[model samples]
Target: MRVFQLGLLSALALASVPAQADHHQEASSQQAEHLDAGRWVTLGTRAGPVTSATRSQPANLLVAGDQNILVDVGDGTAGQLAHLGIQTAGIDAVFISHLHWDHTGGLAAILGLRAQTNAPPRLKIYGPPGTAELVSGLLASMVPGATAGYGVPGAPRADIQQMTEVVELRDNASVELAGMTVTVRNNTHYSFAADSDLARRFESLSFRFDLPGRSIVYTGDTGPSAAVEDLAKGADLLVAEMMDVDDTIAMVRRNNPNMPPQVAAGMERHLREHHLLPKDVGELAARAKVGAVVVTHFAGREVGDPAHLEYLREIATNYDGPVVIADDLDVF
Candidate 1:
């Protein structure tokens, strides 16, 4: 196994960093040192839409050669990018795993910032079906700003339509972009039956990125899934989302004290059915035979916390490969 370095921020420091801080200089310096390597930067590791002082939302930066692709633009992505000294205009493309808000919340910032800077047009955004609709809505929401560019009367407004191009992917879809072959497989994040209309209309996807010397598979957000396992087979790295079922449920209940029993039960069922547990990750990694695992999209405990150590132990049960409980900005 190859050695990898953690970000400058210790797990405890990362967990203690004020969520409101604009950026961390230490993290920025560490990221700068790694700018030349082909790596995955865990820009945001938190799961769900809930805010956290310790973690940002789900997002990742795939630095492959000269291409800077965003795997998932969750909320706070823009700010996180700033920490790495990356301008929004520097992004070459975006690959969205699913349409969940927590996964796509920062897309507006990406689009808006790029447009404002007059970056090259047609910033490609790839995702599952309905992606075009999502982008269209975001463009619509930006009309007011586009129409009033610099408060200059009659100045040519930035054309939102020309600023972005959306490609909607489907199960077993493949595309080549930025010198990488990106493939998608429908995962178990959504429970709808294959033949149902809802399933046709909505898809939760897992992606495998094959770059020059490395391959990384991202299990966006999913439960136990054969398709995901198949997609991740023999990859150099598997960047997966993991959940602590009980802790997530407790967090939800605490946040919504008024949540009725049925509602809470339903939410718990969804969490259990739509997300991966540590054991599930271990099983997937073991079955897929991935080279390594970097766990992100944290849902329960902060990395380095006592409980977080148990997560590694759980994964070690089935997979003996290296496992990392990633914190934000960690590069691998």
Candidate 2:
């Protein structure tokens, strides 16, 4: 039930901001402006931090169109933002899909930015229920009542009044901001709130952002949830995850040796159920009529150079529209 004092002007203020991002602008023009700094860049998408295959950095994306809103925040995010000439505290909103370390580990800078800026606007972070607690705990762990550092020159404006608005976004649940409607939906996955008094799987979120003429959907993390089609109803872009078909199966085989022989038959079924398969994405796009589909969050196998890329391309057979296999900073 967190409320911002400026809710009445929320829409009007946002409306004053830019609605249509620079989608129609020429790449050459955009490139020239960003020549000193790479126009669209890649921050961190490497497989892992270790020599071992499983150790990999999390996935994240940033958009600086009309108003700045981050889609996700993962490891190396601080540097990435720095590279893009963006101030950590300057971000207006951070839209987290789910609370996986890979997706949000770099949030340290969020609070850090506030501390350095003298407790500016209580950053209005929007996420699931657990998000508020996480932000509070993280802030407390770093410094007690860091909010007290209330005034600093050139510091970010803080609004502690609306610390964390954990919007439990369900089907069709939308909020008005900047002349756009951000529609949210539940994306069911294996991840769930744990059995402890503290919920375990309460750590993830996905979203569909409808900004003016263009709409984009970020399926934070999901296997194959029908809710995606619903959330992405008519988005221009559907950014999704892609795990290797064979690699995933292999991992399951290694981890679960007690599987029945019939279990092998269910791999295909499970793949669709837990994650968005390449082919399935095409079908989803066509069915949902989203303008385009972009696949990212690549496993090493799926992202393997030219050969693996072609394999992923085959998945596009299911749909008829523009498809993008994402890199770090590929702007929409």
Candidate 3:
């Protein structure tokens, strides 16, 4: 596994450059004009399962009035929620995009913590077709913790089954939760695996939240998708995932110089076909005519100043509206 270790090291080394120090604070209080009620706070902005020192895994919290909706409960989502002073019991619902570890890792943690705190009897979770199975597995895995907590003083004694409500969804499904009409559309995240067994089992979803006087679309780790474009049309905010093509190529090369050409080609194909390039995100936002776009779910090298500007410039070529490069805990 030397190659894997080297790849991780290379990613960390490239991410360690001081140039990227500003990615964590780029939107620090300077752009408050876009901030309003129906708030959207990005809890973790990093892509994939690999956590970054500057950002947590992919999680976003949408707070509107008395409702709190969590989108994509990635690893450390519960911790980030606690860090933001949001009560674990206050989470109204959770919308998961896919079954990827990076997106669903913190589900058990959130549920367990909520149970431990005696927040609520049931956690409402909505996701794609396999969501029930995934949540069941997570709950089963947490049996030890749940059992151990039973003997503790004032601890919650509910079983995982009694504490979670998993709602499985399909493409074009619409549901009302927390006073918002949420529409789910199938994105191209899993299209690359069309021939695989997993393809038949699960799906990836993008969410559009129609809240009072405001609309937000979270493109949960998708490529350029026409369905997503239609769902996000004219949205007040589009929280989209973006990738740096060149940075990813360079990172792969740096980490796997000896990798076979075919393997490298395959990796590049996946990156290009499954993730939204900087320009693609711009084009999507422009086509959707979104009011503003918040770039998130970073899928490449660290987002430094120079790289951020380059990305913004590329996006500006197509999307003229506001574009904010979000960091962890940044709200809009």
Best by lDDT, which number? 1
Worst 10 residues of 3 by lDDT: 1-10
The candidate, 2 or 3, that scores higher on lDDT is 3
Give RMSD (Å) of candidate 3 vs. truth. Answer: 9.6
Q: 164-187, model 1: which lDDT tens digit per residue?
A: 888999999999877778899999
* Model 1 steric clash pairs: none
Each model's lDDT: 0.85, 0.56, 0.77
Per-residue lDDT tens digits of candidate 3, residues 1-332?
A: 00010211212111111122456355435323222225677888888634577888999888755678899988889878876667678898889998888888888788877877877776788999889988888888878887777677786566668888889988899997666788999999877466888777788999998876478899998888999999999887889999786677777688779989999898788677888988999999989988788888985645455666888899999988878778887766
User: Where in model 3 is the C-alpha error above 4 Å?
Assistant: 1-37, 150-156, 192-198, 252-266, 300-304
Q: How many backbone clashes does candidate 1 have?
A: 0
Q: Which one is best on TM-score?
A: 1
Judged by lDDT against the true structure, how good is candidate 1?
0.85
- Predicted structure 2, TM vs. truth: 0.68
- The regions of model 2 sitting more than 4 angstroms off are 1-66, 144-171, 191-204, 248-273, 302-306
Residue 192 deviation, candidate 1, in Å? Answer: 0.6
lDDT by residue (tens digit), candidate 2, 36-120: 2111222444322122343225444434344456666677676666645666666666676666566667777666765566544
Model 2 lDDT, full chain set: 0.56
Show model 1 residue runs off by greater than 4 Å.
Answer: 1-37
